[model samples]
Each structure stands twice: as C-alpha cells, then as structure tokens.
Target: MRNLFPQRVLILFITVNTIFSLSGCVSHSKDNNDLLCVEKNVLNTANAEGSDALVLKNFEARPANGLLKEISVDLPAYESVVYFSTDHRDKILDAANRIFPWAAKDLQTIISKGFKPDPKAAEPSRNGLYVLFKLPNNEFLLLQGIASPDAMSHFTINDNGSLKIKLVTFGTETVSGDIPLVAYAKSDNLYDVFENAWKNAINTEALAGRTAMRHEKEYPEMFTYLGWCSWEQYRRKITSDLMVDAMQKIEESPLPVRWVLVDDGHQHQTGFKMGDSRMLSFDAHPETFPNGFKPLMDLRSEKIKWMGIWHAMNGQWQGLHPDHELRELDPHLIKIDKKFRGEPLPVMMPKGDSISSWMFYKGLIGSTKKHGFDFVKIDNQNRQMRFYKGKENPVKTVSQHAQSLERAAHELSGGLINCFCSDLLSLMNTKYSAVSRVSVDYLLNNMEKAKSHLFQSYQNTLWMGQAVWPDHDMFHSSDKFAGRMMAVSKAMSGAPIYLSDAPDHFLEELVTPLCYSDGKLLRPLAPAVPLPESAMISALTTPEAYRVVAPLPNGAAAFVAYNLAHPTPQQIVKTQISTQDYQHAGSFIQPAVPKWKVPEEGLVYYDWYDGKGGLLNDQYKIELDGFSDCFVQLSPVKKGWSVVGCIDKYLAAAAIDAIEYNQSELKLTMIEPGTLVVYNKKPVKCAMASKVEELGGGLWKIYFPKGKEKVDVTVTL
Candidate 1:
C-alpha cells in the first residue's frame, strides 16, 4: 500500500480505541501538524492499504451515534464545495450539483477551468460512493464510504465551520454491516477528483457533452416543443370542457401551440388522502370527463397535434386501491402495506415479479395510449424512491428498480414522459424522460414568487439543462399583476412556453415573445442562464439579479430582465446598462418583433412592450414600473452600415424571411410598419420605398407600411 505521505513525515501524538463491538477500530494522530485518522473494518473486508498518514478520518461506526458515523473537514478560505448525492430517496448515481453558496467571481473561475482526473488514480468504496472537496489551495479531499447494498448520502456544515458527510438508511430496509468510511487527500482539482471517483465506481468520464447527447437521443421530440398546460390557470379544477375550450382558443390564435397537457385534476383521485379516496385507476374522473380522456385527446390531436396528462409517480397517495385494474390484472402487482396502521396500504410494486414489473407497466401505459394520450407528465416521483420495496433478486437495489420502472414507462409510452417534482438524483436514471422540472412551481401570485421563478429558472437551467430540458412550468398573461414578467422570462429562458389562461382572456402580448410574426415558435439558440454571482447569492439570500439571456442564430442577443422590486407599490427600479450586460452580444435586436434602430457609434435598445428605444452609451440606465419586466433584442452592428428602423440586420444581411439588402439599392421586407435608419458617408437619394426622410448626420430614415412583405429602396450616392 502507498503511504499517504513520505516516511520522513514525523508523527506528534496518536490515540486508538474501539467504539462499537462489531465495528472496526478508530485511531487519530497528529503527523506534521496535520489531523489524521484511521478506521478499520469499514467494509466486510479489511482495507488493502494497511496504513496511510493522509487519511483524515476513518470510522467503522461511532458508538455515541449507534451505527451512524460522521466526519468533518475544514475548507480552505473562500473555497466552496460540490456535493453529489446518491439518490433522492431510493435512486442511485442520478443527480449532482455544486453545493454550498458560491460567489459570482469564484463560480466563474472554477467552472471556466474544467478539471480532468487521472483514471488510474480512482479509488472508490464498495458501493461506489465517494465525496470530493475542492479546496482553495488547488487540492482535493476525497471521502469514500464503505460499499453497502444501497445507501443515501448528503453533506452539511457543522457548528465549527467544517463540512460533514453523512450516510443514512432510506426506503423500508434498516440492514447494516461493517460501515467503513475512509478519507484521502490529493493535490488536484474537484472536477478531476470527481472524475477519478466516477471512474473508480462506474469506469466512465463525466463528459458534459456526451451525457447531454445521450439524453437528447433518448428524448428527441421534447428538446424543442410548444405546448399549453392547464395548471397555471385552472389548477386542480381542470375539466374536459375547460381543456376543449383551451384547445379551441389556441386553434384560433396565431400562436403555434403543439401540445395540450392536462395537469393534476383529470384523474379519479390524486394526492395522499386515503380510505374513501379513489385509487389511481389511470382512468379519467367520470364527473370531470364523462366521456373519459378520449374526447379531449381526440380534440387535441385534431387541433393541437399532441396530448399529455399528469399523474403522481406512486399512483394515488402512495397506495393503489384494492379494486384497481392493476391489482385485478396481477395479484402480486401491489404488495400489502403492513408498514402502516388503520387501512392496509396497497403499495405499488413497480419492480420484482414479471407480472408486477413488466405486465403492470405495460398495461398501465398501454391503456393511456389507447385512451389517445401521447405524452405523460409523471409527478411526485421521489415518493417511489422513498417507499418502494422490491421482491426479487438482480433488481434488489433501489437504483435498479427505479431504472426498470423508468424504462418501462419509456417503452410503453413510446418515450414521451415529462418528469415533475422529482429529486435531482433519481432524475439521472430517467434518461427517457423528455422534460424535467428543475425548480419548484411557478407561482404567480406575488413579486416574491416571481423572483423565485426567475432565480430558479436560471440556476436550474445552468446546473441541470445538460441532463434534460429544464421545465420552467407554466406562465400566465391573464394573472393581471405578474403576467408580463412571467411572459418575458419564460420566453427568453429557452424553456417550453406553456400558457394557462381562460380561453377568452388569452392576451396577445403574452404570445408575442414566444412566436415570430409568421407565428412559428421562436426557439432560443441556447438555454438562458444567469451569471455565477446570481446563483450564489440566490442560494443564501434573496437574489437581486433576475435576468436570462441567450444568443440568437442571427448574431443578435435576446434578453429578459425582471425588476423584482416592481411588485412594491410606487417602486421604480433604476437599472444601468453596462458592458457586462451583454458581453457576448453583437447588437440588441428583437427576434420576434421589430424595434428601434441603433446609430453608427452607439447602440439602440428597444423594450418589447412599447417598441421604444434611443441611442445609448455604455453607462445608460433605464427605469421600470412596478410588477413589470422588459424583453430586449441586441443586433450586432456591421462594420460600415448604420440601421435606422426596427429592421433585423441579421435577417437583412442573410435575406431571411422577407428581409433583403444589396449594394446600391437596399431592398427589405417589413412585417410591421416602422421607421428605418440608414447611415452612409455621402449624400444618397432614396426612392421606391413608402417614405424616405433624412435624419441628418449621414443617417437616412425610411418608413415601410405594415403587412408589406416586399420593399425596395434605390440608393444613389
């Protein structure tokens, strides 16, 4: 075995003792002013490395805690941690995140300098569980737990300001063995350390691009889809008539909505209320949909193109009604719930016997398809990981069972499952789930809730977008107060823009941000995200930054900024436009709507709401009204051309849509009537356009009529 430090390292003092009778031995010592500890019998077997000085803490079990062992290590000043949890409740190796609160500068520096670990240096524990800490001094501290059949792990800070890693039992099992916990030190970065641990456990690199591509291949259609859901407006009171009315409204509107999702209220029973509560029969509620979900499904397919419905992952209230079709189809499908009192719980057995796992999922998903549903929103899935008990070998582990269930859902549903209210860890196993909710619900009642949605939308997209398309929930234009902010943020975030409003009250302004003039869905070039500072501050305190920006394929940058202070009565938020406001942008240009034109030297900024803008320098500032937000488009200015109107320079340069421009005569198309600005060095005569006026300073202003798809301007110099 390799010594953690060189033999020249001198030891100061050593203490050794045995705490638990069945557990292994524990020893602590000071060598070269470093704290060290050795734990024996962490696993069923002994450590191959007999002695290592750098091992900080090794524990079989703490007698004071009764089979629970804990260890704390100090973090270098200003250095944060990245904590990886095993599963939400029962899944394994599924979710990961950079933990603790991180400042903007720190996060930016670390994420920019990616780390690569040496594959051969990995040393994972038996169950392949380990924790890696990146220190400020450019070193890594690794904690490897004794491998067990299955375990759940997390980290917290102790009172003494030290990071602690804890492992506890989950699910219905309390089985325990030699609980081994070992620690190691390395002069490497956290990313490398994580890669080493992952290589040791699963023998693979945690390549971001590769993982993203895998999910993309698994869920092709969900990556970019336009849909409308019922939760934001109707909540749990959704009915067939409401759904049909919403579909009819969408069909009439210019919005390119494709999916009609039924959230929460369609089922016979949902939630945890038991006894008289109906079982999750996977059947529509008779009162709400007397004709069942088929009528709505048919209407959606004919009018909207696709259909989807929602259900709790554990069925109704973590138990199946004894009279449910699943139980009738297979006797062993639902195990009797002896874990509870009063009513005998009929727990869903998603894994185990062939009839319980395969046949149950097959019949359940097959019924939904036969009912005309094409997609499903699986919600409250974390409960499945926490409560499920397996009955067979090979699938004994929670991760195995979860994977099996997810696969069954994918295969039966034809790979169109949207996961909601699921823990981050279990989501990893849902390679088949097309869309995943990254944060909590998008509550639109107050400014605080609006801020939360904007904050989480950016943070979650940054951390989890690579794994799956982050679902930002639904937005509302008819909410009266928070509608504008909701519309702007959702449209810019590159997330699915689903609106839930009364059919007659649908606001056209809300749809402007989501679609182009021609009514095609406006897909963002990339997922919008906030800066590092925003994420760090949001974790500990109220996040002041509420912005999501993405680059367009037309070299224009689209951004949505929310003045969270807007909800306060009489509050005017003054925000400055700095160079950092759009570091990767060329010039701001609206992707969906035509806006103000920028001058030659300074850029022009246009607000989506009023289509207003003027020339501004780097230090310009703007004020916003209470509870309102703005969407802006930045288009890069070409070398020798100055634009005057709301013409899309990128589109004009590429002749996209109806925009076309050439050398002498600049020919363009306008979806909306707007003034155009043209800058030339010499005096030019303009003709053929609707109206032409000189704005002096070699800038010419031209006007085009609305609905004019073709316009020609002859320029003579």
Candidate 2:
C-alpha cells in the first residue's frame, strides 16, 4: 500500500510475540521518499504491518441525519475501518492513542502553537489530510482516528510508531466509513511518548472512587481461589478420569480450592488432529467425556465454587460451530464461503437482530451449562473483532459480536466470563469478566520472562486493572527457580490463582498458601505496586521488588515485597520436582533477615520469613535470593513488645498463617502434624489444649495436633 500523502510504500514486519528484539537502523532521511525505521516489537505482531506495506485511502465518511442505533463493521484481523470527513480528520489525529477513561488527553494540552522540533527545520505544514510527528531514529508517530459523537475510534500504538485503530459506532453511518490516515509526532523513543500519553490520560481521568466503583461492580469477590487448569498438564488430552482423580487429590490436600478449570481439552472439534484449527466444537469431546459433563459437575462442593471450561469466541477459529443449534435458525448467520472445520459456521451479522445474536450465544454457552459448568474462560476471544460477513446481512464488526456475546454470557451464565486474548477497549466500561488475562503467556521457570511478566502485570494493574482483574496466566507448582516468583506476582496482581501442574506435581508446601488455605483467601494488602525505576536494580543484578502495602482484615498492616528475579532464562523448560524435594526445598534457603525503617506509626516491623524482626531502624535490608520474598506484617507495639515471627512445621502455610490474632487473642491454625513456633516479645498464656514452651527471651513454641482448625494463645503484657 502507498501512503496517500507522501506516496511512501507500506511494508509489514513480524517480530517477537511480546518483546521487540530486532537488528535495524534509524536513518536520518531528509528526502520524503525515504522511510526511517526502528525495530517494532508487539504482542500481536502477526497482524501488524510496517509503513512499507500498504497505504490506506479514505474509505467513506458521512453524517447520520438521525441517531444511529448501532454501527458494526468487520475487517480482517488487525485491520480497522474509520469513518471521517475532510474537516474531522485533524480532530481524530489529535486524539490518537488515547485509552479510554484512564488516559484521555486533550489536543490543546498535547500541542503547542507552531511547534517544531528544530528552529531551522521546515515550517510545520499539513500538506495532506493529517500531520505526522517525525520521531527519533528517523521514525514517525502516526496518530489518527474516526470521530463522531457516537462514532469513537479505539487505538493501540506501538513504541515504533505503528498504530492500530478500529472505529466504533452506535448507529448506522451516513458517510463512508473508510478514512485511513496516519498522524505523526517527532520523538527519539515512541515508547516514551506512549507512556507520556498514559500519564496525561491519568491526569485527566483521575476521579476518586472510579477504580473502586469498577472493582465493586466488576470484581466484587476480588476472586482469589486455588484453581487447577488443564492446559500445562493435559492440553487436549484431558479426560474425565484424569480430572476426577485430580479433584480427589485436591480435596485430600489441606489447601482449599474454589474453582476447578477444565482448560482447552473437553471441546469436540479438531480432535487429535494436527494441522487442523485448534478451535473446538462447543460440545464435549465424546471420547473424553463419554457420559457428558455431569460426572465433573457432580464433583463440585461448597469449596469448589465453580467448574469452568474453555471455548473459542466464534466457535472454532472464528468460524461457527457446525453442530450449533442456531445454525438451523438463520441461514443468514452462516458465511457460505467459509468452511472453518469442513462446515459453514454462523457469523454475527452487523444488521442482525440482537435477539438472533443472543440466541446464538445462548445455544453455545447453554450447552456448557447443561453439562454443569458454571464459569466459562472465553479463549481466542480476539477473533470476536475479526471481520464477519453474513450471507444475507451487512458486515458485523468484532465490537458488535463482542457486545452480543458478553450479553449472552451474562444472561445465560450470569456474567461469569474470563476474557482471554480480547481487546481491552471492549471489556472496559461494559463491566466485562471479573478476571482477564492482561499480559502474554509467561514461561514456567524462566526468571527473565518472569521479570518482564511481573513488570507487565504491574503495568496492567496501573493502566487496565480498573477494567478487570489482570490475570498473569498460570504458574507451575514445581518450578523451584521461578514458580514462586510467578506465584507472588499473581497474588500481587489481585487476579485469580490457578495452577497447571498435574495431580502428582501439586506442590502443596509452596503453592497452596498463595491463593487460599482453611477457606481464607490470602490476597495482598493492596495490588502489588512496582517500585520506581530509581529504586530498582537491573534484572541482571537482582530480582525486581513490588511493594504491597495494605492493612489486613486483621489489625496488622502488611508491608510485603516479592522478588521476581532469577538466574537463567532456560529454566522455563518443562520440568517437575518430586513431592519429597518440594517439601524440603525450604530447608536449604534460610529465612530472610531484613532491616528497614518502618512506614506506619507506633508499629514495629517484623520479618515473617523465619519470624525474626524488630523495631524499625533508618534502613531496612533483607538477605534475599532470586525468586524469593520477604514480608513485614506490621503489628502494634504495646510497651515495646511485639510478635516478630512465626513458622509452620510442614511449610504448607505462610508465616502469617501460623498466627491469627485480633485485639486480645491469637489463633494458630495448623496445616500439618508438626510443631509450631511464634517469635514474640512479651509473655503469652496458652490454652490447656496446647503445649507451650519458652525457647528464648522472645520466642515461644506452641504445639498443636496436625490438621487442627485453631489453637488460642493469650498475650500477657
């Protein structure tokens, strides 16, 4: 494609999935014919095209005489349709890359009068329909969009000046909906410009309780649960027997799980067939669940709050399910030219009735509900935006399909949806699923990737978290190097906790306490906040630290820090640790000894690792290794006396789990048949049912039978 303004050719380039690591050059070109370039890295690189690829011209632009009900346009993957008139083109460019709600910056604040990079440079001129900012390394940042009161354009801009935008409309368009234009900015690093845009957005949209309102409405439970998914372990090979066995094992463990996830295997289409679309028919795989999903449904208990299954957005790889019941309802729903899995599947038409789309979704989601599934992890959801063309109806954009499916999931299944691979713009404000995967899939044990993942999770928390709880995907239970690192990151993410390890690989000692234990969810005091860049050492030197400062439901405030650093990258290889080794790995790493100035008033900082801490000093330091963490749960210091440490014999529970206290009483919950220790400052009176021993001036030993629910301890000042 050739650019309409300068007539430059557009070329498409594909880079890594999440990170951009390419060898390219930034040439300073004065000639308009020359294209300056920098390496572009993006998560969805497959669909991205470079400036050399194609030039898009004005498609159409018209004003609706009346309020349009809704406008839905379907385009190819990564392709977007924008409607614009000659006058509105500049207005759209000024609003490029503004993420809704959180980051909306006005053009007046963004631009200055007669702004030019260099005094000697050519006077700023708009020869074409829009202006482009020349960037560093001879690149340009293009900012352009479609703007009508109801017709808003959503955009995703890359650090390399590559931008993707989709025009959203509430009503039919009277103008041509195809004004493809690129806006520009001059910069050394386009990524930095994007960050500035986000900051500017925050300044404009920082309304008190806005985030809180979202949390309460979209994620009331703040869903923290011990979940098991079938992806990492079983893949498409999961069976009824295997899940049943896993459920039995989960029940037997001291850890409590509220949801059991049936990841990616139960669907019926593309069976055992490589080179076929990974999409599956919504029906359960006959061989895997011969008797239907009733067997799995029967396994739910009070602790097992929901059983979730995975399915694609439009059935299989953006095609309709051949076996879907709605196929007979409307022949117009199916695109005759598309044989997704050897059959023409239905597509959500733009001009179709809401009832038709609702009924279509009802059939798919209803099928799972019939089999006793309560939650649905909607995968390949990005396909909902893929351009759709029906045989008899107008083209439907993914935006319309997304809204239709969301409503259907809400109406049919009570809005219990976990959106994966879906656009953030669609989910936000619509109050989509409580849980959403924000970052790309992380490595099982690669600490480097884990670091990047942690940074991205925190980034998502800061920017997109208000939309939904950001999920960091799954972490294995046996990855000694980075498993716990990822787990801590997940907990800090305020998202759900799910393990993909097999039944035998369940590392109770390490994994159970992260999400839940004894029916109590162990969430961070607040969402994990990334430390400022100044406070952080490079990933090459030390693990990055994220601070979670929140007062527990109990009286104590939590000052916890998680380390997401590891030694190597290849550690993410598929490997499993033996049950015996997992139970004993804690023996090798000594408890962290931390020193730091406490944050709260009248409170003393006590390290929870091995339970040894004291009064806050000027500096706080800890002996931490890679993938390890230290928490300083702030306790009130009455008469200079405080409980500094606690430990569980089996390592099944966290140090915080060793002591549960209110104003006057402390209850120690036991997870294993072993001894417990409470390192405290003052004397403590124990109940008759417990055995207490004085180890030293401040350490107290409290012994309780294995699996005991609670043991009381009274403190004497």
Candidate 3:
C-alpha cells in the first residue's frame, strides 16, 4: 500500500487460514518497526508493519531444490482477488475472469461461500493462470504461472482462505534441471503488473528462444486487405455451387472484398453430425464439391486477391476416422480415458514424433495447396493436451504439433489463422503463426452477446496480443444491431478486417469507412490494448464504458470507448482522453524508432466521428450512450503544424502514405483520394489540391480529386 517494495524486486503476497490447523506465532521487532517472523511455516515481509506476511503450507519443489525455490510467508489481509480460470480440467482451452471480495472480519463466511478450491487433480487442474490481489491500502499484487509441455502450473483458493499452488511435470516425463514455474510482480498500476509478470514468465530459460514476441512476428499479407468469410453465411451447409455464387455476388457488389475465406463446411467427413464427425480423407466431399476445390477457385474475380479454407488442427474435430488412408502413418487410437455416458471415449490421432507429425500435417495442407488455396484457418487447436495426454510428454507433443502445422502451412500457403487456441500452452507454442482468434465466434442479432463478444476480445488482447495478432473474428456488416460499433472497433483493433455478410447483404455504408476503394484497410500500427486505468475493471459487471487505445502511424493515436453497461444505464458514462494515454505510442513502432516525434509544443487532438479539435495538453471528455462508442484521435504537432491525415476513414491517419515537414513547407503523400485534414498556425498553399477549405482554430481541409492511386501534395507553410 505504501510502495515499500524495492525498485527491482517484484513482490507478491498470499494469506491463508488452513482448514488443517497449524500453530504459527506473530513476532515484532522494536528496532525496525516491522513484523520480523510468523512461525515455522510462515514467511514474513521485511519492511512492513502489522499482520502483513505470506503463509506457505505443504511446500514441495521438484528435483530437490531446482530452479523453483521454497516460499514461506504469512500474507496480510487482502481486499479481493481477481483471477482467470477455466472449468474444464482434462482439456483446458479457455479461461474467464472472476473476482471475489475479501474481508478479515468475515473469514468464516468468506471461506464457506466466497471461494472453493477443487479437489486435488492428478494432472494439473485448469484452475487459473493469473491472479491479482487488491491490498487493503489499494496496492496490487500479481502472480503469473507458466504452462508448457514439460511443466504446467496453476493455483486455487481454498475454502479456508489458503492458496494452493501446483507445479508438476506432464505424464511421466522427468526434469533433470531447473524450469520456471511462476512469476510475481507488484504495482499500483494493474496494467504494469500484469504485463511485467507475463514478460518474466515468457523470458524464462525454457521459453526464451522457442518463440517470437508479437512485435517480431509479421502479420499475414491478407491482413492488409478487406476480406470475407463463409462461416456465418453457410455454416456447415456450404457447397461448391453456393461458394461460387457467393464469390460472384461479392465481385458484383460495391464493397471491395479482396480476400475470401471458405470457413468450415468444406471438409470431408464420414458421419452426418457436424463438429463430432471424423475426417475420412483430405479430399473434398463429392456430394458438395462434385470435383474438388477447382470450381470455387476458378471463379473469375480480379478483386479477390487471396483465398483460404478452414480445417481443425487435428484431421477433424474427432480426429481421423479408423479406416482413413493416412492411418498407416503411425496412427494411435487415443482412449480419452474419461467416462462419457458410462463409456470411455476414443479419439484417433497421429503419432506425436517430429517426423510423423510433420508428415501428417504436410499431407493434409499439401492437398489444399494442390487445389490452388492460398492459406488456411486452423481451428480447435487447443485440444492437443487431450489427444496426447498419456502417450507422450506434453511439452514435446504440443511443441511438435505446433511446429509441424506451422511449417507445413508456411511452406505451402500464405499463412494460418489460429482459432479456439488461446490456452496458455497453445499461445506459447506459436512460433511461426501470426494471427489468432482471441474471442469466441461472433453472435448474430443478439445485442447482449454482441457486447460480451466485444468486451472479451479487447480484454483478452491484454495477454493474447503479446504472442500474435488478435483476430476479433468476423462480423456481419449488414446487421442493424451492432454493425457500426463493430466496424469502429475493427478499424482500431489493428487486426484483419473481414466480414461474413450473406449474399446481397453487404452494407457499403458501414464497410466503406474501414478501408480504401482498393480494399486496403485503415488499420492502426499496433493492436489496441485496454486503457491502463480500465484494465482491472470488468466491463460486463460494472456500469462503465470499457476504453482501449492503439497507436497509429505518423505519431497519431486512437482511443475507442465502449459503453457495455447492460439494461442501458440512465446516466451517461464519461471518459477522459489526454496525452498520458498516448505517451508511449512511439514504442509500438518497429526498429525502436519513434515515427511521430513529440515536440515541446505539444499535440492537436480531434474526434474521428465528430469534427471537434483542441490542444491535447488539456484532457478531452467523451460521453457515450448504452452500447455505443466514441473514437478519438491524437496527433502530435511539429513546427506549429500537425497533419491529421484523411478524415473520411475511421482510422483517419492510416490513409497517409508519407508525410514530411520543414520550417517553410510540408510535403504529403496520400494512399487514396480523400479530404486531407491538417492544423497550422498560418495559412498554407497547396498546388496539387483541387480546393482547400479553411476552418477556424488553425484547422484546414485539403480536398484531393480521384485520379492516380497515390496523390502527392505540397503545402507552403
């Protein structure tokens, strides 16, 4: 609470009132005025007064004092706990957020009803990956666990206020040396603590060289173009003829769709059921395809630049069928070993060796390449743990599977879109993949679910965005419910912009603002992250707007505020935007260089949707209605002038191809013909512009006519 921790030492605290009573005494030191000791099993804080200590009970470290050292402390009382946990243990996929209030006086009631730890599990329970405790004085403590193939970590809060931490090896694999199990950090800023703990966990010796950081990875080429998917339009009923018709319609529409994703429904399966069926072969179903992927791929469309297909990470949701031809490639009938309707479930999977796994995936993806597909959307990738549970070491199995799939896809196709694969193991295994679906499938025509989808997508990006580009999934641009809000968010998300509109349902009005006429999207330079102050607050439970910020090219930043309050609160939710929000925007640029150098003169701020301008040194307040959003842009001023880029697009600054300014002149290069907005203290002359409209407050709008793709203009300052 008093910021007592040293600058470099990360602090994490835990308090426990064990059901199995253990004797512990509290002692104080007169010279230091701090709690010196708390008994045999208790670990005391060095620079704290009162009952501030951490308790460690039943401590056990693997390999007899390995990398993980023993921890013992009697933790002080906390105000509440914020954790991320999943209900499924055997096949841990996704985790959701939960918060529990704590009080020292209500220990009995809190232990009985507030928190309940699950029974001990043979395999590491999917209990939780991250935990945050709010101290009584408003400071925060964070704990982050590592999830890898060789080792897995998780924690649980006991009913008696005890915290149980588990770190174990997978299957029968043994560790000869040290491995990172957990990381800790403390900060008054929740965002700082969460990010620091994650960095520490991933930077450990076991994980450091295996994966690439988000900034180091390159987003797939399809991300720069506007795209469309067939999932929401045709689900599992998609056919060759249906897909051809959809492509024809897309080409005929005014909306410029550059890429097409044939999601799901096109796979060859043996059973009538969807999702539960097993793949019989890599060939397309004869009934639906009639020939193969040729008919759909041969569609004449110059606007469609790239096309891809979807399939599960495994051969299918239930893996390959027993009689599949590829079964000879070291196939194993994995007995799920879990009772389903009083019977053990069986799943077939390829052998987890490097050679066999690589060959299996190469065959499946090669078939797609032969048919002229450019990329793939691999789904359900988080089920690796269940398929190879006892057959091999989890670390090797998961790492091999990921490497095989990524290698095959990268070698044969453009890239892969990873879906349903945000689990800790899967996230850490993304060595070559670039894009990942961060949230569940997009809901249609449901307002409540739509709000939840948006909220989850932004919140999950706090961690998921660190490993790969976060795909918010696809949304229907024609829907009247939340189409505008989704479009605005996508423009700021720095992710691929794709739609799932059915035939003849494309809404040009809503889609036009997201990209140029050539289909290039107006995206931010980096993915949007939750505003630091709003990181700890749950948007769904609180009557407040969830805010996220992204840094744009040219030193501009965009902030989107979403009103996710349910039941439509009567009072308006307001948020403030200032220079503090974009102070770190320069760090997002590549090569460790700042694109838009901030001058001592400060910046010029403006609203994207509304034509409002002001000095960024003063905070700007935004008020929003229920389920709506407000997009604000901040541009730094240089030499008493600022280029606001294209005002027609949602991410206005993204439309500028290049900009250079000096004491007497400013040169601008535009990506497309639009109204270029700039702020200057004096009048300026532009020769290439068709006309110039001058607004008050040093604001000017320069109109460029539609002609060449790249328009260059010189303004005499």
Count clashes in each candidate, considering only residues at least 3 apart in sequence or on different chains.
20, 39, 10
Q: List the residue pairs that clash in candidate 3.
A: 43-72, 43-73, 53-74, 53-75, 54-73, 54-74, 54-75, 55-73, 55-74, 149-395
By the TM-score metric, which is better: model 1 or model 2? 1
For candidate 2, lDDT tens digit of each residue in 1-717? 111122132322222222112334223233332132324311221222232212122223332422221211111231111111111122222111111111112222112344322111222222111112332234333233322212344443322323344433323444232222222222333222222222222221211111121344545342545677778766777888888888877667656766788876676755353223433345677787887677778887777777887776655544443444444445446442344468654433222456666655676788777777776777655433333322221223443455566666666664354444423324432434566676545666655556555544554443344345567787787776666556656655556777787667777776654632444445543344333221122232233454434334223444445554344332321211111111111111112112122323344445545555444443356544445556555544444444432344111233334454454555544333245444456666665436777766465666655553443444442
Task: Give the per-residue lDDT of model 3 (tens digit) for 1-717.
Answer: 223222222222222333222344434332433332323433343333221212222322332211223234335576665555543332233231211111122223333532333211122223556666667676767666676446666555454656545554344444333345456666665555655566666665566655666777767887789999999867888899999999999988888899999888777877545435778788888889888888877874689878888888877777776666665554433334333357543556766677878888898799888878888988877766655554436556767787788889878878888887766777777777878888756767877767767776776776677677788889998767888888887776778888998959888888988998988888777788777546566565567777888888787888888887666677889887877777655433332343344557788888877786756766788898776888888887887778888887888887886788787888878888788888888887788888888866687888878643887778886
| lDDT for position 470 in model 2 | 63
Candidate 1 per-residue C-alpha lDDT over 586-654 given as tens digits, one digit per residue, 9 for 90 to 100:
211122122223434554444445444444356346566655556665443444333433433212212
TM-score computed on alpha carbons, candidate 3: 0.83
Ranking by TM-score: 3, 1, 2
Indicate which candidate wins on TM-score. Answer: 3
Candidate 3 lDDT trough over 10 residues, lowest sum: 96-105
